[model samples]
Target: MSTFQLPSSTATTSTAYSSDEEDTLPYPGELSRSDFLAKDFNPEAYLSSLGRNRHQTLEDLRSDLRSRSQLLNQELLELVNGNYEEFLSLGADLHEGEERVEGVRVGVMGFGREVGGVGKVVREREREMEGLLVEKRRIGGEVGVGRALLEVDARLGEMEEGLGIIDRDEDEGDGFDEDDEEVGGEKGSSPVLRRLQRHTREFLLLTRMVERVGSSHPFLLAQQGRVDAIRKTLLLDLAAALRQAKAAKEADAMLGIVRMFSDLGAEGEGVRVLRGS
Candidate 1:
């Protein structure tokens, strides 16, 4: 084969591989570059810098990942601690519930589980309620009786007032002139006599009530006695006034006077009028 000769340089030349030439050499893989700029391109050094950049990025990523993982672990630990504290509280509450259940069991055993005692207590309470109802009824009856007595007392007061007015009118007069008394009695005696008759009837009604309730209320019996005395005094005074008024044909007064005498059991005085003398 004929050898091919390259052109010789005029100055000294190095036979060693230049950095640019080494960069241009075919690597293990199919890669190439411009031989003129291969020294400046420096592919190996560029690749080393790229590898360093990749490693530095990987290291920084790993450090950040480690710090994040540490934070996650701390959060997990706190969550676990919180859950553990809740678990402990729940355990204590469960223990208290168990104690309360045990106490209930002890109480049940102490009472011998007798339901009869509870029933007996309920029955006694019912009986006490019944007694209270009975007392309430008794009080209601007493209140009714008291109201009736009060009405009777009011009527008696009206009668007393009328009698007081009559007494005052009689006292103010000079004396009982038979003619004047006859004229006045014909006009005025109707009212007084009617009032007296009404009082007598009312007194009889009151006496009956007093007789019925007097044992329970002793004061009512005393009141009845006073009423009876007043009735007798009023009848005697009214009879005397009528006898004086009868001379001038005071028929109504004479009739009322006779009725009062009969009520007082003074039959002798009542007989004098019945004979028309």
Candidate 2:
């Protein structure tokens, strides 16, 4: 028998879209159509698997070992070059909190930027919703109740529920300060903080839903606008509360709080407090 090499399969599951094809990127918290069509597309599960896997493949295992060995060799070379005592002295300095004294972490502001980005998305969704309502009003008279309209109504209801959660959050009547010592507990322990976080989460979830539904749906777009408006109004109310506190002769307390917010990179929030004052 003659030995022969088999031809490759005609199907190309691994190849990406052709270069000539126009590429489309996904919006935040969204996946591209290609991602949905992928055989393995679960991002959370993929991340978990990578975290759990010591060696995902032979190549991965080899690469990891090589990296560790190279690091060891570098460390040994440094020690031979009389850097070991220097490293030891550096470690002792860190133990005495010399590294922590720099205080650079206070101005990072990464989390504030993330929250601001979310707030911007929420505002954009609100504008989209206004356009949707205009469209719905335009077409409502011509076309009566239909399946598409019903779907829009359902999405609108979900958006309403999301907003309602934020409104009802204040009904608890705890009246806690924004910088209250009581609300500074560990994650999930402080009721006031939890409520605030929940409100943000709801906004984020609704924002994602609106994006997924697309800007075509008018009711959703309008509802999103309402949600954003409500959140801004709520924040303004907080600013007003700060103003009231200052009026009540809590200047010493309010000033410190406002300054703390500013130092923590929440300059907008600090401005709001001062404006309220």
- Using lDDT as the measure, which candidate wins? 1
Per residue, candidate 2 scores C-alpha lDDT tens digits across 1-277 of 9887444442332234442242453212312335435786886774465446432554664565477568769978977678777878878988777546545454447667888999999999999999999998978843643444555455444434544443434445434354544432333233433344444444455555555556556665666666566456435534554576568766654554454344334569868567654
lDDT of 1 by residue, 94-204 (tens): 999999999999988768656667878889999999999999999998888788678666655555554552244444542333334333233455545555555556556
lDDT of each: 0.62, 0.54
In model 1, what is the error at residue 188, expressed in angstroms? 12
Instruction: For candidate 2, give the lDDT of residue 146.
Output: 46
Residue 48 in model 1: lDDT: 67
User: TM-score of each candidate?
Assistant: 0.40, 0.26
As a TM-score, model 2 comes out at 0.26
Model 1 has an lDDT value of: 0.62
Q: Show pairs that collide, candidate 1.
A: 20-38, 20-39
Q: After superposition, which runs of candidate 2 have C-alpha atoms over 4 Å from their true positions? A: 1-189, 237-270, 274-277
Best-fitting candidate, measured by TM-score? Answer: 1
